[model samples]
Target: MSTLTHMKPRALNLLLLLSTLPVFAQKPIIGIFESTSSGAGDNQGQPGVRVLFYQSGRQWRSYNAICQDEACLKTIVHLYPPVTTWTLFKQGKPVAKVAATTPTAYHSYSEIGVQTITNPAAVLHLERRSTPDYPDRPHAILATNLSHLTDPDNWQPAAVFPLDLTHVIQAFHKLYPHPKNCTQNTTNSPSNYHDSTYPDSQIKMDSSYLSNKTNWRMLQITLGGYLCDGPPDDAYVDHWFAISPTGEVHHLGRLMHLAGAADFAREGHSELLFQVQGGNEAGYKLFYDNFTHQAQDTVTYH
Candidate 1:
C-alpha cells in the first residue's frame, strides 16, 4: 500500500509493466441506493448504506443496504423479500397487476453482515426505518433508480431543487423534493492522469469533497457532484458551498449544466477549475480557491 508519488524505481517499473498487461475491470452493478423515506416523515442520523446490485454465483441478487446496528454503520441482509405484488403501467396507463402466493421475509444465516434479495425488482420502490427514534423519516432512495438510466431521447430533468439564502437545511428540500426516479452513483472517481478523475459507469458518482489540500476540515458540505449517463444524454449538476475554518456554512450558486472540473491546483492550497454550459457566463472558467473560501473568474471564453 504505497502512494504512487513515493514509489521506488523497481516498484515504479513493476507498476508500469503491470499497466501494459491485459486486466479486466469489473462490470458495473445495476441497482442500489440510500433510503430516502422511513415510513416516518422526518429522517435521522448519518446516512450509512451500501445498496448493492451484484451476482452471487449464477443467481443475480440485490444487496439492499439496510440498518441493523447500535452505531448504525453495520448492515444486514433480507434475502428475497417476497415480491408481494407487481403493477405495470404502459405509456402512463395501467396495464396489469398481480400478487404473490405467499408474503415473507428471509433473514440470512450468515453473520457476514449482508442482505441479498433474489427478486431484484422487489425493492424497486423500497424504503426502510433505521430506528424508532426516526419513526417519521423513512430512509430510502432519495433520487432515481436503475430503470431511469436511459438515453437523451428517453431522459430529461425529472426534477429540480433550489438553493436559497436561508441556512436552514429543511428549506432546500422544500424547493426540490428528493429525486425519486434517479439512480444512486456508486463509483469513486479516480484521481490520476491515465485513469479518469470522474465517474462513468451504470451507477454514476455521488461525491462530497470531504477533505482537500487546505486542511479546512469539518462536517460541512462544500462541493457535490451528481451525474447522468454520458453526452447528448449527459445530464449533470453541481452544488457548491463554503465552510470557514471556524465552521460557518456558506451556500454558493448551483451550476445547472456543469461540464466538468478542467483543472485543480494544490500549489495554491487547493483551487478548483471547472466549466458550465449556459446563462450569461456560457464559456467562462470558474476558479474556486479552497484556502480563501472564494470563487473568482479566471478566463472568459464567451
Candidate 2:
C-alpha cells in the first residue's frame, strides 16, 4: 500500500530535486568575526570582543574528511581538534556558533595560525547588531539571531566596485622581491616602517577561480598613505587583489586588516582571516588561495 501511492509526476519532481541539494558533507569552517567599537575614524582600539581564534589548518584538513570516526566526532573545543563546530558566517547566513580554545604549534599558519573563540553569545551577537543605528565598519556584518540553516552564505562579492591598487605596486616589485627593509622606502613607500596605511577594504574576499574565469575578480586593494611617522603600525599593509575581468592585477598578499571572510574550505571560494596588528596582538593570519592551485593557511602562525 505504501508503494502504491508512489511514483509518477516526473518521479516526484526528481525526488524533490534530490531533497534540496547543497550539503557538501559538512566541511566549511573558516572563522574570524571581531565585535565592535570605533569606526568614525581614528582610535579603533577595540576593547570588547575577545576570546580569540585562528582555526585554519587549510580549513582543518579540508573539513577533516567528514569526521574520521572518533565515536562520531563533534566535540572539538581545541587541542588535537580537527572539526566540530564553526557555523558563524555573515553576509551569507548562519549567524552564530563557534568554538576553539586555541592550541597551537603552528603547522597551518598561512596567516600565523592560532585559533580561539571565547564565545559569549558571540559577544551578545556583536552587541545586538551594533545598535545606535549601525554605521558600517568595525568589521561590521552585524544583524543576526541565528537559529537555523547551519551554514550557507558564501560571502558574495565578485564585483561590486573596488579595485584600484594604484597600479599593483609595479606588479609587486616584479612579483616578489620583498626584502630591503629598515625604511629605505619603496614597497609603495610606507617607509621602512609599517604601522598604518589602510585606506579601507579590510573586508571583501571569497575567491576560488582556478580558471572558472568570469574575469577573476577578488580585490581589497587600498593604496592610501602612512609614511611612518611612528606608532600606527597596521593600516593599509593589507593588499589582496585579483582583478582581471579585463583589468589585470593579481598580487594576493601583503597581510593585516580583515576581521572576517569565510568559505573556510567548503571550497566555493574564501579563506582569509587576518587580525594581527602591531607586534602580534593575540595573533592571527590565514590567506589561503584557489586562484590556480596554491594552498595556504598553515605555513606558520607559531
Candidate 3:
C-alpha cells in the first residue's frame, strides 16, 4: 500500500539519521560588510558604515547539482529578511539572539536578515565553526552591503554623533563682549559685531579632539553667512575660534575654503592646530603631525 508506507524500519532509521546530521553539523555565515549612507556627513565628505551579520552559512548559488539534495535546500528555504533577531546556537540550542538594524541607501543593498557591525572582532568563534574551508585556521571574510563589494573608497567611516556646543558658546559670549564700533558705524554695518543677540542659529559649533580628555573642554566655532548669500563684505566676517573650558577664547583664524580638516578627532590629538593665512605671517605655518604632537611653526619668505 503506497510503497508499503514508505519502506522498512531500517531504511527509515537511516534516512532520519542522515537528515539529523546536517541540522546539528551545519554552520552559519558570519562576517562584516561595508555600507554607504548619505546625509550631513555625506555632504561633508564622510559616508560609510560597516554592516555585520551572522546567520546559517548556507549559500544560495548552487553550481553543483549535488548541493540540490533535499536536506541542504530545506535549510536555505527557512532563512528570511531583516535578520534582526538571529539566534546564536550552541550545542543545538539557542544561546543568544542578536539584533541589528538594516541600513538603507539609494545605492546600497543588504541581505534580508544579515546584521551589521561597526568594529568586527579579529576572530569570531561562530565564523570558525561555520566555515569548513578553514576549519583549523581563522580568516577574514570579505563582504559588502553594496552590490559591488570590491571598492573600499565607496565606503567611508560611519556617521558621527551630533556635536553640542551650547555651553561653550554662552561662555565665549559672556567673557569677550562684542565691540561697540561694530554697531555705531552703520556705513559698513557689522550687524552682529556688538550683537550678543548673534542668532544662535547662524553659528556652527563642534567639539575638537583636544576636549576629549577628562575635565578638558574645547570647542571649535565657525561663524559665517549662508552658502547662497555670497561673501559678506562688512555685514559678516567669517572666522574660526577655539573656546577652552576656562572661557579662554582664542581666535584661530578666518574661514579659508570648504577644504579643511573635518575635525581634530581624526588625528586623535586634543590640542589646537591651525594655519595662519594672509597676514604679515602670510607664508608662516603651525601644526601638529608626524614630526610631533606639540605645535610646530615654519615660515616661507617669498
Candidate 4:
C-alpha cells in the first residue's frame, strides 16, 4: 500500500482504480439511480427517470465534481465514458440487466434510449431534450449511452404497505407539531413549494419493503407540491420513515430524496439509495442495515 502522495496524473488514476478493491475484494455493484418514473404512463417510449447518480463504493466520482456548473458539463461528452452493464430493479427484484451499452448522453441528464428497450407496448420517437430540473445544481449527465434505468412494472402498481397516509399523518402531527402554515419548507426564503392553502397541505408518500420477505415500508414523504414553483432548493424533505409490519414506526432520515431501494450487497435485504440535501451540502447517502441490526449510516459526497 502506498501512502497518499502527490503523484502524476496517470499514477493517481491508477491508484484510485485499484482502491475500489481490498475492503470487500468484491467489485462494488455500480449503484446506479434514476428518478423512478418510466414515463410509461403515456406509452410514449419516453423515460421519466434521469441518471441522477452512479454510486461506486460511496463515491459519485465525476458527477460530484461536475454537477455544480455548466462548463464542466462539456467534459461529460468528452470523457471516455463509463462502459458497464446495469441491472434494473423493480420493488426489490431484478427486472433485467441489459447487455452493456452506452446510454445516449445529452447536456443535462441521460436515459436508456428506446433502442435499448425492445418490443414495447408503445414508443414515442422523442427528440433529444434536456431539463434544468435534473442538472439543477449539477449541470451534467454521463457521457455513455447506458442510461440508468427504472421502469414502473405496471402503471398502477399494488401497494407494498398495509398502512396508508393517514397512519403517517397521525404520527407526524403527534410527534412534530408545527404552526399551521402553507409553507412546507422552513429552511428557504421562498419556503412554500406546494399549492396547499394552509390546513391541508399535500402529503406524498411512497412505500416499499427493505427485505425480500416482508410487507413493511421504507417510507418516503414530501410535505408539499413541487409542481407549481418548479423545484425548491431542498426537494427530498426530511420525513423518511420505516414502519414495521406490526405497526411500529421508526425515523430513518434527517434529509434525503430516495433514488430506490436495492440489495447492492446481494445480502437478500435492501439498502436505501438517496440524494442527501442538507443545509450546508448536497450529495448521495446509502443507508443500510436497518432491518438486520441497528440502523447504521454512510455518506459519500466526494
The candidate that achieves the highest lDDT relative to the unseen native structure: 4
Per-candidate Cα lDDT values, in order, are 0.28, 0.38, 0.31, 0.41
**TM-score to native of every candidate shown:** 0.23, 0.25, 0.26, 0.43
The TM-score, computed over Cα atoms with residue i paired to residue i, of candidate 4 is 0.43
Write model 4 residue lDDT over 1-302, tens digit each, in one string. 33223233443454466455464353434333232212232223332322233335543332222323333233332222234344555444454444332233323322222112232212222212446664433211111222333322111223545354567656665554442233543533445433333233565665444443565566666665433333442332547777666777776664666645554444555555665555334445555555443222222222
Worst 10 residues of 2 by lDDT: 63-72
Instruction: Enumerate residue pairs that collide in model 3.
Output: 28-57, 29-57, 52-115, 52-116, 52-117, 81-112, 82-112, 83-113, 210-270
Candidate number of the best TM-score: 4
lDDT of 2 at 249: 74
lDDT (Cα) of model 2: 0.38
Residue-by-residue lDDT tens digits, candidate 3, 161-249: 23325654554455434423233334434453443335556666533434333223334555444222233432234444444446455
Query: What's the best-to-worst order under TM-score?
Result: 4, 3, 2, 1
> What is the overall TM-score of model 1 with all chains considered together?
0.23
- Cα lDDT tens digits, model 2, 184-259, are 3344454454332222243233333222323344555433344444432332355566556566776655554455
Off by over 4 Å in 1: 1-206, 217-238, 256-268, 285-302
